[model samples]
Target: MIDETPVLDDHLHLDPDHHRGIDAVRDFARLGGTHLLVVNKPSWHLGVEAESGEDFREVFERTIDIVDEASSELEGRAWPVLGVHPGLVSRLVDDRDFAPEEARDLMQAGIDVAAEYVAAGEALALKSGRPHYEVDDAVWDASNAVMRRAFEHGADLECAVQLHAEASEDMTAVATWAEEAGMPAHKVVKHYASGRLEGPTPSVMCDKERLETAVERGELFLMETDYIDDPDRPGAVLGPKTVPRRVRWLLENGHDEAVRNAHVETPKRVYGIDTEATLDRTE
Candidate 1:
């Protein structure tokens, strides 16, 4: 074991087709990871050849099964993070068969399903945001509307919302929308954030410099690998061990308390996860 403060990867994708299932979780835990927030990989990202909402739903359900199985294998060490990914929203809008209004409605429906799952205690957070890069104004507006709907539903259910957007995007605007939708700012987490960002919502960063800077600034944030687990791109973005490794880096550099806050305390506060309980179970 890592023999230090417990580590948590706040965001990770763990579909059966790509990820190694229980083996991956075992490896992560061995490396000192206490918990992880497992997100569903959208059909588009997995090259699933999906063309309609039904096709997407099939992929979404499969992903949920993967997450559920992982959680069972890990014995409560993993929590679910489910929602319509913004890229999937863009793809639906771009499909010629779907009218703009229909696409928006479909996206909102996906969020509704995720919210229901969260309310049923099957999930801990909702993942929604705009495209990684800029998009047409109309497409952007529709995606934002879908995200707002997720925020509103998450607020009602008291679940956190994890934002997957471009690092350069205006985080303040996201926080504003969350507030207007009645979700508190602290409940919105900007996924894949960097040092350049500053706003109401806390963020999770992967870049070493950005992670260190945010920690120095005393920013409320978490760490993630965003591990796709794709065999073709093995360890793409970062590996599953990235967060635990980073925790070790921080400890070696004399940032032990920062590591505890980011990997233990912050996640507990935001996602209602109990790292100590997870550790106790694993032990």
Candidate 2:
């Protein structure tokens, strides 16, 4: 049942402390997942205070190393999505005593670092977005500005950019920003999305109606559990196997093509991953 169709979990965190490295990657694989994109977990998930740009950089580097280790252990089944999360940027600026200008520079520096990895084929995509829709105007603007900088870098590298915005926020504006920054709408993914939103391909949670809508529209979107893999909050957002479980459900419901698109084709097109190569790897 787990091997009938290839599955890719587009967003998740894998850390030595929480997710326990290859053990967690094998957990996802055992559930039928063929590939995964490992995003850097926030400071809270790492049990540290990201009070400076250096602290955030450490987190990003650790995340890349974790993904590299997992991919090696899994034989290229795991990939890295690197970036400076907008929430971390806000904290660095607002809470860490760094001026907004300084924080923006640091955020750009982080994107540059991620771009270097992407250029080397070590990472798949770049991520940046507002923490929430309700941040004050100044913070909101700053967040968008930093994300826009990331977009510009992604554009230069021909890499995809994933947005971590609230599901309810209007994402058309973000898409417009990406376009203005020279990134195509298809290269911009709206993460943790729900409801009907126009603009950028959406990477949504596994809900029947949402999945149906995306399939019906022949939309280029992906599905994820956004699984945090935290020990304290077991399956905190969703379990490591959530995406594969959803794929099974979709397949049982006779949406085979949709399942393939969401779990295989979409991820390959958006992240530029070699799905066949990933699928060819043995556990």
Q: List the residue pairs that clash in candidate 1.
A: none
Error of 1 at 106 (Å): 0.7
TM-score of each: 0.89, 0.88
Best by TM-score: 1
The global Cα lDDT (0 to 1) of model 2 is 0.74
lDDT of each: 0.75, 0.74
lDDT of 2 by residue, 146-174 (tens): 78988897788889998888766357777
Candidate 1 lDDT over residue span 109-144, tens digit each: 778777777888877888888787878877778888
Residue runs of model 1 more than 4 Å from their true location after superposition? 45-57, 72-76, 281-283
